[model samples]
Target: MTVVGIGYVGLSAALLLSQYNKVYALDISPEKIYKLNKKISPLKDT
Candidate 1:
């Protein structure tokens, strides 16, 4: 599955779906992509 955007909803959906399927996340920000590629979460936990 290809997920466009890595915002809250997109990231959440991708993470959930990834458990059972292959997921590819996309975003406009290269920084965000880089972070994700490095196994980092762009969203901070409160």
Candidate 2:
């Protein structure tokens, strides 16, 4: 499945769907793209 955007909603959905299928996340933001590419969490951990 393909998911556009990497904000809260898009990222969450991608994570869920990625469990069962290959997920392609697309975002125009360089920062977001970079973070995902590096497997870094965009949000702060608890």
Candidate 3:
């Protein structure tokens, strides 16, 4: 499944859905994508 945008809500949904299904999170930020690819949290929602 493809989830567009890796924001707080989007990322949360992707992570939750990924447990049972394949999820590809999409975002407009290259830095964010790079961090996510490296298993790092892209945004700190606090």
Model 2 residue 10 CA deviation (Å) reads 0.3
TM-score of each: 0.89, 0.86, 0.90
1 against 2, candidate with superior TM-score: 1
User: What RMSD, rounded to one decimal, does every model reach?
Assistant: 1.0, 1.7, 1.0
Q: Which ranges of candidate 1 are over 4 A from the true structure?
A: none
User: Candidate 1 clash total?
Assistant: 0
Ranking by TM-score: 3, 1, 2
Give the top-scoring candidate (TM-score). 3
Among residues 3 or more apart in sequence or in different chains, the pairs in candidate 1 whose N, CA or C atoms overlap within 3 Å are none
User: How accurate locally is residue 5 in candidate 3, as Cα lDDT from 0 to 100?
Assistant: 93
Error of 1 at 44 (Å): 2.8
- Highest-lDDT candidate: 1
Model 3 lDDT tens row, 1-46:
9999999889999999999999988889999999998999998756
Per-residue lDDT of candidate 1, residues 1-46 (tens digit): 9999999999999999999999999899999899999999999878
For residue 39, model 2's alpha carbon misses the true position, in angstroms, by 0.8
Quantify all predictions' global Cα lDDT against the true fold: 0.94, 0.90, 0.92
Model 2: per-residue Cα lDDT at residue 16: 99
Error of 3 at 20 (Å): 0.2
